[model samples]
Structure formats: structure tokens, C-alpha cells
Target chain A: DQQVKQNSPSLSVQEGRISILNCDYTNSMFDYFLWYKKYPAEGPTFLISISSIKDKNEDGRFTVFLNKSAKHLSLHIVPSQPGDSAVYFCAASLDSWGKLQFGAGTQVVVTP
Target chain B: DVKVTQSSRYLVKRTGEKVFLECVQDMDHENMFWYRQDPGLGLRLIYFSYDVKMKEKGDIPEGYSVSREKKERFSLILESASTNQTSMYLCASSSVGFGTSGRNEQFFGPGTRLTVL
Candidate 1:
């Protein structure tokens, strides 16, 4: 059973616009949520993360919002640039062990 | 910078052949993991080791085993390669341990694309 899921497979956005990617998970034990970006033929790189104790966390153009009651999280990239085009994955973890559960990635395209 | 290196970037093997994928980390992390990424399935953990000579099976452990002989190395073994096992394999290491917060991000290798014929 897949505990983490990304309903959208792809998203296209205009440059400098806001791009939102959504994720849902069934596991309530997950407390740490993260977003990773992957380019073709490259490993996934950590983008941003949010803890269950907070509803939102931000870093530069990337921000992650977590809603524990709804078991949902969304990553938002404002002023999205062409360089943001890549596969985005949402991951969750239960504890401090660093083991993670990942969702099907959403491919984001930032068009000029 | 923390570095995680994989033994291969690409490998092609015949079905039923034994396969070995090795990973080495330079940061002396206490935890290492092996994961397979498939289209529309994301990344699935196969196995992980928290200490040398110790390992724990992840969600998908069937047909796979792991070894941790040294603190910085982890090996994933496929007893018999199968077509279904062809996928991009990733290795990651993190420095999360006792007395430290688990907020550490896992550093990943470039990944090895394994093709089982």
C-alpha cells in the first residue's frame, strides 16, 4: 500500500508565476515532511521541509504547507523560473531515524 | 560536502544472474539506505543499515539483501536478477543518531540505472 500519493503527474506554469504541487498521505505518524527536486539523470535534491508542529515553512522561492488535520501538504514555488523545471517528490518520515516514504513525483515545467 | 558514491552508473545483467550494487559515503554517517525509483511509483526503500554488521529490511526487501561491513559502506545484493527488478537504484546516507535531531537531510548518490534482461 502506498502511503504517500501525488495526484498530479505534471504541471506547466509561466515564468515568474506561482506553481503549486499537492501531496496526500495516509500515515498519521509522519511528522517530518519534505520536498525534493530531481533533474534528468540526477539524484533527487532536498528543496524544503516542514515539521508537523508548524503549518508552513519557507525558503527563498520554495514554501511547504502542511495540514495535519487533512493529511495533506503542498509545495509552492513563487516566481517560478525555467530552472525550476524538474520532477518534484514529496516525502514524509515518522521519526528521527531519517528513513523516508516518498510519493509519486510531479513534473513541473516553468516556461519562459 | 558530503559525498555518496555508487559502484555503477549503469549496469545490464541477464536474468537469474547475481547482482551486487555497492555504495560508499565519505561523511561517516551512521545510517545508509537503498531505494529503487520507478516511474509513477517514486522511491521505495529496499533496505537500510544503522550500524556496521547490522541491517533492517525496508518496505520492499524481497529478492534483495544488504550488507554493512564498514561504517561508510553499504551493499545491496540481488540473489537472482529478474526483469521486474530493472529500475533506478539510489543510495543515501544521513548523520542522524542519538542526541541529535532527526531533521538532517539524506544525501543521495547520483544513482545507478540497473537493467535486468
Candidate 2:
């Protein structure tokens, strides 16, 4: 069974628009959540993360919102640029030092 | 900067052949992980090691074995290659005090595309 899921396989947005990517999880034990962006022929790089205690965390143009009660999280990118096009993965972990459980991933396409 | 290097960018092996994939991390991290990435499966952990000579099985560990003789190097061995094992393999490393108060992010390698024919 998949503990974390990204139902949307892909998402597209125009430049300078807002792009939202959603993710859901079934495991309640997960206390930490992270988002990673991956480019073609390269590895997934760390984006932004939020602890269970926080509802939102932002980094530059990217923002991550967590809803523990709903077991859901969303990534918001404002003024999305063409360079933001890539695959996004959502991962959850019980402990900061433990292994992570990753979702299938959502491919984001930002058009110029 | 954390750097994780894999032995190869691509490899092709025949069935029943023994294949070895090597990974090296320059961050002196205590945690190392091996994962396989498929088109729709994202990334699945095959094995992980927290310390030298200590290993743990991840989500999928069948037909795979790992070795960590040194802190900087980790090896994944395929007892006998199979067609179904063809996929992209990724190596990642992170420090022990990851998360909470320390650097919990993992650094990944360029990845090795393995094809078993």
C-alpha cells in the first residue's frame, strides 16, 4: 500500500502565474514532510519542508502548506517561471533521522 | 557541498551475470542509501547503511545485497541480473543528526541507468 500519494500526474501553468501541487498521505505517524524538485538527467534536489507543528513554510517563490488534520499538503509557486518546470516529489518520515516514504511524483510544466 | 558519485552513468548486462554498482560520498556522512527509480514508481529504497558494516533492508531488497566496508563507499551487488531489474539506480547520503536541528537533507548522485538483457 502506498502511504503517500500524488494523485495528479502532471500540472501546467503559464509564466507569472501560480502553480499548486497537491499530495496526500495515509500514515499518521509521519511528522516531517519535504518536497524535492528533479530535473531531467539529474537527481532530485531539496526544495522546502515543513514540520508537523507548522502549517506553512515558504522559500523565495515556493511555499509549502501542511494540514495535519487532513493529512494533506500543497506546494505553491507564485510567478512561476519556465525554469520551474520539472518533477516534484513529496516525501514523509516519522523521524528526522529515519528513512523517507516518497510519492509517485507530479510533473510541473511552466510555459513562457 | 555534498557530492555523491556513482560508478557509472549507464551499464548493460546480460541475464544471470553478476553486476556491481558502486557509490561514494565525500561528505563523511554516516547514512547512505540506494534506491531504484522507475517511470511511474518514483523512487524506492533498496537498501541503506547507517554505519560501516551495518546495513538495513529497505522497501524492496529482493535479489539485491549491499556492502559498506568503508564510511565513504557503499556497494550494491546483484546476485544474478534479470530483465525486470532494468531501471535507474540512485545513491544518496546524509548526516546522522539529520532533521530536527541538523542538516536532514539528502544529496543524490547523477544516477546510473542499468539495463539487464
Candidate 3:
């Protein structure tokens, strides 16, 4: 069974707009949550992460909000650019060194 | 910057052939991982090693084996290639302790796309 799930397979947004991607997890033991971005033919790169102790974390134009009570997490991109078009994956881990459980991934497309 | 390199970016093999995927990390990281990314299935861990000569199976281990003779290199072996095994294989590495800002963020190599006929 998939512990992490991204119900939406794809999302499209206009440039200079806000893009939101949602993820849900079934495992409550997860303590660390992260978001990764992947381009075509390239490996995933870490974007941002939020610890279970914090409700929200932001870096530049990206922000990740975690709701532990709901077991849901969302990633938001402000002023979305065309370069932001890529696949976003949500991952959770029991600890910092433990293996990660990844969601199916959501494809984000920013149109002009 | 941490750099992970794979032996091949693309490979084609025939059925019944043995396949080997090699991964190397420039940084002196102790943990290495192998994952396969498939459409709709996302990325599934195949194997991981936290130290030299030690390995642990991930969610999927059938038809796959791993070798960690050195701290920087991790190898994945497929005894017999099958069509179902054709997919993009990824390698990642991270330090044993807390990574940047207390998160064990992994550094990934450009994936190897393996095609089995």
C-alpha cells in the first residue's frame, strides 16, 4: 500500500500566478516531510521541507504547509514561472536518516 | 555541491541477460540508495546501504540485488532482465547524520533509463 498519495496527477497554472499542490499520507509515524522537483530526463532536486513540529516553512517563492492533524501537506509556488513546470513529489520519513516514502507525484505546468 | 554519477544514462538489454547498474557519489556520504521510477507508480526504493558491505531491502527487492563494497559506490544487479523491469533507475546519496537544516535531503544522480527487450 502507498503510504503517501498525491491524488491530482496534473495541474496547470498561468505564469505570475499561484500554484498549489496537495499531498496526503496514511502513515502518522512520519516526522519529516519534503518536496522535490524533477525535470524531464533529470533526477529529482530537493525544494523545501517542513518538520512535523512546524506548521509552515517558506523559501523564496516556494512554501510548504503541513497539517499534522489532517495528515495533509501542500506546496505553494508564488508568481509561478514557466521554469517551474515540472513534476513535484511529496516524501515523508520516520527520521532524518530513514528511507523515504514518496507520493505518486503531481505534474505542474505553467503556461504563458 | 554533492555529485552522484551513474555508469550509464541509457541502456538496452535483451531478456535473460544479466544487468548491472553502478552509482558513485563524490561526497563522502555513508548512505546510498537505489530507486526505480515508473509511470503512475512513482519512485519505489529497491535497496539501500548505510555502510560498507551492509545493505537493506526496500519496498521491492524481488529480482534485484545490491553491492556496497565501498563507501562511495553502490551497485544494483538484475539476475535476469525482463520486460517488466524496463524503467528509469535512480541513485541517491546522503550523509548518516542530519542533512541541511535537520533534514536528510538526498542528492540524486542523472537517472539511467534501462530498456529490456
User: How would you encode candidate 2's per-residue C-alpha lDDT over A1-112 as one tens digit per residue?
Assistant: 7799999999989999999999999999998888989999898888988888889998899999999999999999998999999999998888655588889999999988
RMSD of 3: 0.9
Candidate 3 regions off by >4 Å?
none
Per-residue lDDT tens digits for candidate 2, residues B1-117, read: 669999999999999999999999999999999999888778889999999999999999999999999999999999999999999999999887756533487889989999999
Name the 10 consecutive residues with the lowest summed lDDT in model 1 chain B. Answer: B95-104
Any idea what lDDT model 2 has? 0.91
lDDT tens digits, residues B1-117, model 3?
A: 679999999999999999999999999998999999998878999999999999999999999999999899999999999999999999999887775667678889999999999
Cand. 3 TM to true fold: 0.98
Candidate number with greatest TM-score: 3
Question: What's the candidate order when arranged by decreasing DockQ?
Answer: 3, 1, 2
Winner on lDDT (1 vs 2): 1
> Which candidate should be chosen as best, given lDDT against the real structure?
3
Local error of candidate 1 at B104, Å? 1.0
Q: Which candidate, 1 or 3, has the higher TM-score?
A: 3
The residue-by-residue lDDT of candidate 1 on A3-100, one tens digit each, is 99999999999999999999999999998988999999888988888889999988888888999999999999998999999999999999788899
DockQ of each: 0.71, 0.61, 0.73
Candidate 1 lDDT: 0.93
- Candidate rank order under TM-score: 3, 1, 2
Against the reference, the lDDT scores of all candidates come to 0.93, 0.91, 0.94
